[model samples]
Target chain A: MNLVLLPEQTDSTIWQINDARQVSHLKQHLDVKIGDQIKVGVLNQARYLAEVVEIQSNQMIVTPVEQQAIPNKLPVTLILALPRPKVLRRLIMDSVTLGVEKIVLLHSYRVDKSYWQTPFLEQLDHYIQLGLEQAGDVIAPSILLEKRFKPFVEDRLSVWNHSQTTFVAHPYTTDVMPINFNQQCQLMIGPEGGFIPYEIDLLKENGCHIHHVGNRILRTETAVSNILGRLFCA
Target chain B: MNLVLLPEQTDSTIWQINDARQVSHLKQHLDVKIGDQIKVGVLNQARYLAEVVEIQSNQMIVTPVEQQAIPNKLPVTLILALPRPKVLRRLIMDSVTLGVEKIVLLHSYRVDKSYWQTPFLEQLDHYIQLGLEQAGDVIAPSILLEKRFKPFVEDRLSVWNHSQTTFVAHPYTTDVMPINFNQQCQLMIGPEGGFIPYEIDLLKENGCHIHHVGNRILRTETAVSNILGRLFCA
Candidate 1:
């Protein structure tokens, strides 16, 4: 953990950190002691160099200093077809660190029924927190699950107007990946076997541009990072 | 395995498949039968759709057909600090699937000495084959291991002259990533903890341009894929 995140505080003068994992990271990685300044950020708030006031195995108390600068978030939403359980945690963490403003996990025809049953789906907040700590940022991206694909696309997608560019990445398309893309966009990535023909049609009809990265096929995780790299300055 | 790769053949019409993993993937995933056409590629050669002549639990016989198109390789070499053993296989596989022309696994100050001793290094060809199969390509990129960091940076890096952009990804740099980089180049990525000051100086003296992706600190794997995605069309 690069930065320790504290819960919403009632008293701004001092803060108590009770999360065991954060405490351990402070104790083990940072080698904390009284008077040592640790990098810290309040939940959805500014970052600070917090001075350690008290230290223990289970908890830590610190006084936060002046607010420090934080990195900017990418102006995008990742509309991902819910991946398998084995691929969930790391993908979420990577997406969070890459600084997506939001993520919507949607269902598709190629996604197996058993994949939605994984217990890991409930730990989205934890993965977001891990990603935030890794990125040394305080604001967590909102994650929304759209179990029904067609209805969500028809109804909720209108929330993003023409000003926003929505894209669906496909392997069969002759269209090329967008270069040096910096504008607001929503990128939809398919599941393992890929989105069915009908699903691609639905997205295309909804004004989503269909593009392929290159001739070679990349795995879901690799494709996400690669696309994000070009989509923003990441 | 998306495509079946065959060993270099002595006879053009008939070929033997002896690899057990390939056999299992063909039986379970593709479910091949006699007279069935399967996508196949010869090592470092052209791709083709071959007809299955015979099938068995341990072996398969196929007849090669007309050449098919393959994806293009990235116009650069990946000069990476040898990562931990756990990260080596997948990174190599990802690099191959991303279509790099060459890879140089170099040693650096922060790289643990024990990492170089991994037996997994011997299975580089296995990872390359898996990558080629996933991308449906036949050519394998050459991998060179440099145990002496100073000598390699001072002596070998000049193989890429001023005409070819050579970069060092350093987090401390204010320089931004190069965009729409289509020409030949070499990118150097550091180890987990990052390269030391002395090593950075040595690299600077060798004409490596220092640059950073963004503010967020990403894992070595994520950083590599992110950089490649921007460096080329991958």
Candidate 2:
């Protein structure tokens, strides 16, 4: 029942909270009070505990308690094969919560053409907002769309070639994926059925290390989170 | 497009494909036909390529091609707080695909009481079967339920608590969770909002080490998958 959120702050001294939608949410969903202390942030600014000073029909005012420290981001960039729309939403939210700096949604052979037509791409800002609200962080990760696999691998991937490490998550491989903290990393994960042998070979040929998490295969979203978690720890 | 899945059989002459629902899945969804080669598995035997000989309404019969060796399971046991029904299904299936040998679903303070009544629990066998089918494996992991957290931690946790190493995932913790595995270990993850401070303290007092993945907090299911992926790799 945590109601603290960022991007809700309107201004300093006079915190203009006039969001008719949020007003209803505060009144009905969260039962917020005039004097209740709520956690809030001001887009990339410090998070503060604010005491509600005033409440109007669609606006509210609050005073900040204290400035908070910002947390560092994870030292990895994730390149995932665009999954189904439903799964993509969860992946985007989880990636933000896990503190990834960049996310590249690439087209793969197994990806259905219908996934690209999802409204989620148009509502990318909304997804970012949901992530920021949950993580209590201000910085948003950059999301990139790579439609062609070969060009992305040959052209765009070279920029990240100097990364501390590069990993391709494929289940068919026997080699284990290792997490090394010596440098920044770029992690590539496949779609539902995983990358075909030719795609895998292209990644391998272009300096990406093919790694396996285990014998069993996982879904695209689960594999993304799992790989990030493991890599962060390693 | 790679159909090498049909050339790994060796010993078995007859492939008995039971499970009525799966039979329908093969016929309708996969559009599998007689004379079509598909990947199949024998009970605890090996994954092999099989050519469909008989496609009945309720079952299918196939002949094997060659035998493939079985891979080892991940070296960690996951004790997860049972999440809501929807998340729980994904967690169970993902955990299996990640190669876990055993899983224990424990009740935690953050778990909603209503989640216990989900129809997914009754269809647990089907969920496990889905995992096995995806991974092309024969052996299924054992699933256990602990309705009470305290008693389970007090009575049973000690027996399972080997110096093999135990970890409890928590946020805002000083200790970083280890990724490298030195021996067999047990890892526990909390529910959606995470375990209450009291539950965390109790688990810590009972010989579990409290460690965090990173500063960025992750969802329960994500944390579980990540922890297992990292631990098993080491």
Candidate 3:
């Protein structure tokens, strides 16, 4: 909430920007004023210090200076089973903040049918923007959806076949947790109840090694974050 | 809820023990009968299929059939800033279920003073049991408390200064997201408002490399889970 985001910067030397929402937010909420400097992150650009150039009726103009590069992202790509719409929204933002390069949301047997119809799918940009605004990063990860699991596994998995490692996280099964992984990898996580035995078998048959994060059953969102943290820290 | 944990067996044919609390939980909550078959994990022993042998008014007896090894835990150790009591309780349970070998709850600037007086610390064993029951693991992770950040960083941190990589996750840094981590590692996470610059500087000086998940700010719990997942996957 401390960082301000602008949609587009005006080219005029004395850039005049209308910020009704921000004005109400700043004057009434944050109690900001004309000469104060605020952190601003431009869409797809580095963050910068912005001086409040002018304040008018529901509008505020800011002058940007000294651009700073946003931090780099994690190298891995994450492919997750689509969770409930409510959970999916939070997960999308979480993943973005964690620096995942790409995300693929696939359907699974345990996924609720109603979740696929969520209006959030239509406004993917909004979700990504929320993440960018929070972390002050301008780059958005690529997001894709797979309505069916089998075909995607059969057709698209080949791309990951040559990958140094591919891990499929499940609650059961005994596979050594990976350590010090220095190569490009792909991680596949299942739905809430986890991948059905058949799904697990199929993934195992396809070269994805089954790994467990311990014995505790984690909710979809918790599992995603836990797996990511472990993978990167290693 | 699915798997029940039993104390170490004594002699060749009998399980040593009286756990009044567990006995009561099984009777009142799970509605266990004299002959119900239950999944049981021995402390440090493999999970075994056990059949109820006897049920007394205040005691239950079971015999093991087959031994099964529990899955491996996450490869990294988590050093978290103590969150509020409720969140801390949840974190303790979650960390256990997720299979972390150790958890260090330390003091940070943002940690509320009232949190230090929580009853959760007095009942740590109860939280550990909940995690073990869920994950079916017998060994509990070692828990430690550090009241002052500087002293601990200067004195005790050397023990964690092994070959394993150490990372301090911060939101504003420009460093590339970590990837393909090594086998053993240490991760430091900040509190809600995050680590102040001085604290971050102190940690950096103490041999921790600063890193970021991405651009979105995540709650402490979410950050822990995400980093664990990424580290395991990597």
lDDT of 3 by residue, A115-204 (tens): 889997877776776666556677778998899888887777755766656788886888855654535788788886688998888787
By TM-score, how accurate is candidate 3? Answer: 0.69
TM-scores for the candidates: 0.94, 0.87, 0.69
Native contact fraction, candidates in order: 0.71, 0.67, 0.67
lDDT of 3 by residue, B1-234 (tens): 446776566654556225787777777867888677677777666677677788887777777777766757767778888898878877888787778888889998888878888888887777877787766677777889888888887777745675666788897898844665536888889887799998998887777888986656777877777666665552
lDDT per prediction? Answer: 0.87, 0.75, 0.74
| Pairs clashing within candidate 2 | B6-B49, B8-B66, B8-B67, B9-B66, B9-B67, B10-B66, B10-B67, B181-B234
- Of candidate 2 chain A, the 10-residue stretch with the lowest lDDT total is A1-10
lDDT of 3 at B149: 88
lDDT of 1 by residue, A11-68 (tens): 9898999999888878886678999988898889888998999987799999987788
Give the native contact fraction of candidate 2: 0.67
Candidate scoring better on DockQ of 2 and 3: 2
Q: Give the TM-score of candidate 1.
A: 0.94
What DockQ does candidate 1 score?
0.66
Q: Which residues of candidate 2, in runs, are more than 4 Å off?
A: A1-3, A8-10, A14-36, A54-61, A162-165, B1-12, B16-33, B43-46, B56-59, B162-164
Q: Across residues A20-52, which tens digit of lDDT does each residue of candidate 2 receive? A: 765666677667797887766676666677788
Q: Per-residue alpha-carbon lDDT of model 2 for B133-224, expressed as tens digits?
A: 66666667889989999999988886677555678888868998876674678888988778898998889778788988765556677777
